[model samples]
Target: MTDEQIREYFEKVDKNINESGYHLTNVFATAETPSFCYSTGIFKSFNIPEIFISSLPPGLCSEIIENYVEAFKESKEAKRNQRLDFLTERFPVYLIDVPVPSLKEYVLSSIKIYGDEEYKYLQVIYPDTKGNFPNDAGYDYDQEIMGEFNN
Candidate 1:
């Protein structure tokens, strides 16, 4: 994007962040990558790790992230490695720590918006219909759809 476009986009995001507590960014899928969505201002507003989810439609991802943020705000107990069964009825989702190396590649907008300061992030991952995660045997989903989770 051009500098002017980037500035306008950031301004819009800032406006949303000011109106609500956060702004959700939905990235459309490309031929080589699956769709993903993330939240900006979660950490700045709640002191919690920002949320990220992949391989899901933008609407569903937005719902999950918004709900998760609400839950975290109410209880302040959500954290990495936690299994959240309430996000989806079809399957439970796991929150994994997003490695530093992956942040630049995936959550660059958040990085820029947050002034490139240190902040935490958690990746929401769900298993296939068989209830098997990426590293588990019998997992049937395409691994590329979820991107790389070094953690």
Candidate 2:
């Protein structure tokens, strides 16, 4: 799709979500690929971020709005839930942090698995600091085997 077409489709999803009474906090589109991601927060608050990523090559653009609408409907039904639960239930999201201030090594090491034949895309949604990666996310970031289940 052309840039204009991509913009139009994203706007359609945004309109649909806004009409449903939820506020969209951010939408990030990649210029290199036909992929776009968006996050929704409760009543315009940014404390909670529920992200959705879609890869709309060319023909699949038609379902963008429908997908967003369905997600919005489901989210409304499961109101005030944990974003971590919502994400991990659908995707293989995990936490990895090497102790002794070498987290960069661990993150890069795990990201290597994304290049393997099985995984098509890898989306890492991290906050500004390591301290911000949600404490109650079931595991401590300081300990864990990197890429154990991700690969």
Candidate 3:
């Protein structure tokens, strides 16, 4: 498919998430393109982009709806500009959420709970096992395996 067609395919995902009350706001997805591609590939395996629903805080939901509603309320020309801004600007990406969701509990899950006191919360949702990530890099490089020629 042409780039436009490929882009068109991604549009469905955007539309579904938007309509589902999911905004694009969360910790930035800094996963390398290769790892991201790999993870998204795993997500696809679980029929998530279609069946996997997420959860959202009510406040965030209202914020997203207000912004979307305000944008669409503008006059035709303004509407076009608003849409352009949304698509072109790097807006915060909030994962779309399903009303009530359940996660298969894991010992070390993606949803890490961290806080001092009072302000505690479950983390952003995550995909299953194949999508699991390690805590830190532990591998050591061998100089014999990588000479200047490796570069």
Candidate 4:
């Protein structure tokens, strides 16, 4: 999108954040990447790291993220590299730190909307059908689904 379009989009996102304490942004998958969704105001509202989830449908991502935000508001903060069983029962999910480099690539929208301030983020990593994470011994799912965070 053009710069102007992006600006307008974030203006709306800012309004949403102001009204509801957060906004969810979903980026559809391309041939070389997987679908992803992230929250934009968790840090601002709860003074905690914002959440990101990849390789999930937009609706499911929204559900999981919303649940996470609610839990966080209740003082249940998810720690880095910890398994988060409360978000899902189908398979456990882990929260990994999203490094500065990966943040520029994956969660740019959040950066753009929130400005150049240092923002902490935790990626929600879900396992494959056999319960294997991207870093597991027998992870069979496409690694792209986890984005570049693992690298």
Tens digit per residue, CA lDDT, model 3, 32-96 = 31111101111112222211212333344344434433443343112210112341122332222
Return the lDDT, model 1, position 147.
36
Model 4 residue 98 CA deviation in Å: 1.2
* Residue ranges of candidate 3 with Cα displaced over 4 Å: 1-53, 76-91, 94-151
Cα displacement (angstroms), candidate 3, residue 87, comes to: 11
Residue 40 miss distance in model 3 (angstroms):
31
- In model 4, pairs of residues that clash are none
Best by lDDT: 1
Q: What value of lDDT does candidate 3 attain over all alpha carbons?
A: 0.26
The residue ranges of model 1 lying beyond 4 angstroms of the native Cα positions read 143-151
**Least accurate stretch of 10 residues (summed lDDT) in model 4?**
142-151
Question: Which 10-residue window of candidate 3 scores lowest in summed lDDT?
Answer: 142-151
Residue pairs clashing in model 3 are: 22-96, 23-94, 24-92, 24-93, 24-94, 25-93, 25-94, 54-97, 54-98
Residues 1-151 of candidate 4: C-alpha lDDT, one tens digit per residue: 8989988998988898999888898988898787878889888877778887777888878778777787777674666566778876566777777765665777877787668776778788888889887767888875344333341
- lDDT, candidate 4, equals 0.76
| 1 or 3, greater by TM-score | 1
TM-score of each: 0.86, 0.24, 0.20, 0.83
Misplaced by over 4 Å in model 4 are 2-4, 143-151
Angstrom error of the Cα, residue 83, model 2: value is 10
lDDT of each: 0.76, 0.32, 0.26, 0.76
Residue-wise C-alpha lDDT for candidate 1, range 104-148, written one tens digit per residue: 777777888887577777888888778888777788865343334
Best candidate according to TM-score: 1
Give the candidates in order of lDDT, highest first: 1, 4, 2, 3
